[model samples]
Target: MQRKRASHYIPTSTMELERLYRLLVLAILVNVVRGRFLPGPWIYAAHATFYGAEDAVATMGGACGYGNLYQSGYGTETTALSSVLFNNGLGCGGCYQIRCVNSKYCYPGSPYITVTATNLCPANWARPTNNGGWCNPPREHFDMSKPAFMKIAFWRAGIVPVAYRRVPCVKQGGIHFNLQGNYWWLLVYITNVGGPGDISKVSVKGSRTGWIPMTRNWGAAFQVFHSFQGQSISFMITAASTRETVIAWNVAPPSWKQGAIYMGGQLG
Candidate 1:
């Protein structure tokens, strides 16, 4: 039997070499092609093929722009202006404005001021459903994935207080109690203050005499009308125990207040 040896075909002319190079490049691209490119796709070109350029531009906002595009308005000066960016670049007309906010159009849904989380507690104890301050939040994004717990300090707009009072809690204990249930709520409070300030993590001990997992009710720094209301969380101890629950709120931050007296009463 005779074996056929593979032949290596080489191009001759410059044109042929270029053509071969192009063909090889095209083949590599074809082999790697899946659906579309990442970071940004060419959806507009596909739309234009079917709907035409003008129609595609009007519908999906012309190419190169961030969002939907609109034409000039009635008046000359007003009409002269380019696109206006709105809704996080959702609506664009003639001109572009970075980070423009339109109060007339309310951004629907829950307004949650997302922040990083802490180790001692679950994510829920971070912030409330509807709560925010007058000034814009410092950072645009809060990455919860890093660190045990994020230290969020909130300060009020104005301030004027001489001798701040600190309230004392009658009983320092977790609020929710389940002798043989799945979940429990921790409600602790603090007293003696005059303005918004920071609060540390509270220690929770179950009736069975084991320290239960407890996190801060609110962020580290927040404005309290008067006394501090710690976070209400659901948690389980290393092992379930039932005797007489004893919980206490300890100022977590400032390290010095590690074992400071808690003036707030504990409730479920």
Candidate 2:
């Protein structure tokens, strides 16, 4: 005699089938809420204008402490955020996807372009907000690099309506810590951070000392007055929006030099 085969269970009654369907739907919803499944990026209304030449030379080393767009790995795809979005330098290093919309100057079927926030587009109190003061308070604006603007709209438009959204930054290699200041004062300009990219809080630890919080010096740079020379240094960085923390262990050695950039571990 052949062994008895196990019957495959299936819902037969209407009530049983409906209950199974409900459970399936609930499981999907739970996964979505838990971020197991991600939705599309949220779109926001804004305006954009170009400020620099095609080479984007003028866009480098602005409000953000990250010097030299090329050396910092930001390249020409960068923007200067208005005060409404710059958020007192906390917005630095955040990435955005922007596209021209509802304008004749918008390129036909133009794909959206991604840019890193590297500077601040200051408000001009002398001009009217609707006229010359595009970066005035209450207005969300992007002062994009010329190359970035040309990707979506004609430069002659001067300013164009744009739809934008925050996106995770995709960076190569690891995070970079550019060491500055003297032995007594240490300033670290962090660059090439992934995930949300913008940093809110930073803490440093030395081989001989406890963890010490660093103050935001400007843009992406953080400063600590205490000296940590002749010891290995570690950093704990927190993301601005998500508050996600990433600890980079022993990022700099005792032989670390000023103006030199050291590679720390990256965040996701």
**Per-residue lDDT tens digits of candidate 2, residues 73-160?**
9999999999999999999999998999999999999578999999999999999989999999999999999999999999999999
- Could you give candidate 1's per-residue lDDT for residues 1-268 as a string of tens digits? 9555568665659999999889999876763432111121211110000112222332232221211222211111110111111112111111111111222221233121211111111123245412321112221211111110111111121111111111111222332221111123324322221111112333443233344445433322112112112332222211111111223333222221222333332321
Q: Write down the TM-score for model 2.
A: 0.86
lDDT for predicted candidate 1 compared with the true structure: 0.23
Among all candidates shown, the one with the greatest lDDT: 2
| Residue 108 alpha-carbon offset, candidate 1, angstroms | 45
Candidate 2's C-alpha runs over 4 A off are: 1-40
Each candidate's TM vs. the true structure?
Answer: 0.17, 0.86
lDDT for position 152 in model 1: 15
